[model samples]
Target: MSDLVSIPADAPTQGMEPNGWIVVGVPTNFFATASAHARSGPLLGAAAEVRFTPVGFRWDYGDGTSRTSASGGASWAALNLPEFSETSTSHVFEQPGTVSIGLVASYAAEYRFAGGEWRAVQGLVLVPTTPIIAIADRADTVLVAESCSINPSGPGC
Candidate 1:
């Protein structure tokens, strides 16, 4: 019965800034969730109905830096975290270039069957979720005479 569980597919959804490039040494936010991408019932070949929730994320920042985020960090602007202004899932890039970021999404699974109560699985399972995200980190060489917040169209702001 355990063998039937096999490996379930859970594609994570990614969310981040559209055009803003991450600045060197500046913390940038990345968002993702590791829930079932598609399903209405028990997974195929599984003995029971299993539901997976993101417990953590393993991040490869493409610069030899790796970190684990437990909460998948909210946006700093959203949560109002101070200083580096980061969510739990934020990363700091030290160089300027196009870096490929990889995520090994970890999930805690629970299973139940027809007329049975849900029970947590033994341990966490990790899977490489979706295409590797490429983040463009640029040098903060642009000189802004005015705050980018005040005038987004201003020169280099």
Candidate 2:
């Protein structure tokens, strides 16, 4: 499966607060699925084919933090919740700057071809993790005397 398919690049990365805003200790999300294929070869013996499916992910938050998750993180809207209210994979940062985040997708494959019974692979295989993506977070300090509900103009609310 490793040689046949690569991890999808549509990994989720968003919910980041912009400059002048300080939203900390919040949950963000990411999502990626697997691709399937079956081709002709001796490996198949013209009697079998293979399918690779993403089972989970190991994530690097790039701030000396990492975690493994069973399901891809979802968007706030996808969960029908307000912004910053829910998450599947999340991180907390002490200070802010550019952070390098990455994901190593694990796959569980099965073989079924020529109308034969499906057989599961013994274990999971991981994709190469050399390539990674980065995100920037900003830190700001603001002094405000009013609340967003009352003032709706307070800084950093």
Candidate 3:
């Protein structure tokens, strides 16, 4: 089996927001289940640190709240020789709504032990899921067919 990791965006569920919050990182993806009961349960838990030079990252809470952070040419090899870890800054949402999260990490290209030159690695984006309101006054649901189009092209002709 492959190892899985979970990252939680530390946000408030109730009461007033606090300054400087820390997010819990888990080894598995538990945001979907945990966030559902975040109001009553622990929002931040144990989380694994992600290793790699992160150039930048962005988060979009479907509720119309978003945030972004970036880093410049930081050398990790000097500290530990080609390895580094970074924890994201904490953010809180005043209102409850769906949230879409994205992340991007970059690594400086390095020549292999054999031979090569320095290069740059492309960034990455991860969209976990749209956060759903566990408890809401009113809920709306919509359904649609998997493979259906409003305007047909050939068969009828």
* Of candidates 3 and 1, the better by TM-score: 1
Residues 1-157, candidate 3, lDDT per residue (tens digit)? 0111233223312210111121222110111111211111121242223222323434443346454555312222322321112323334334433333433222221111223332322333232333333211222432433322552321111
Best by TM-score: 1
**Model 2 segments beyond 4 Å from truth?**
1-25, 33-47, 128-132, 141-157
lDDT per residue for candidate 1 within 1-157, as digits (tens), equals 2432464747566655332456677677776765553223544444456667777878787788888877665554566543345466777887777777777888777777664787777777677855455556566476656787887645343
lDDT of 3 at 61: 32
Q: Alpha-carbon error at 48 in model 1, in Å?
A: 2.6
Best-to-worst ranking by TM-score? 1, 2, 3
Superposed by TM-score, candidate 3 places the C-alpha of residue 115 at a distance from the truth, in angstroms, of: 3.6
Q: What TM-score does candidate 3 reach?
A: 0.28
| Lowest summed lDDT window (length 10), candidate 2 | 13-22
lDDT of 3 at 97: 33
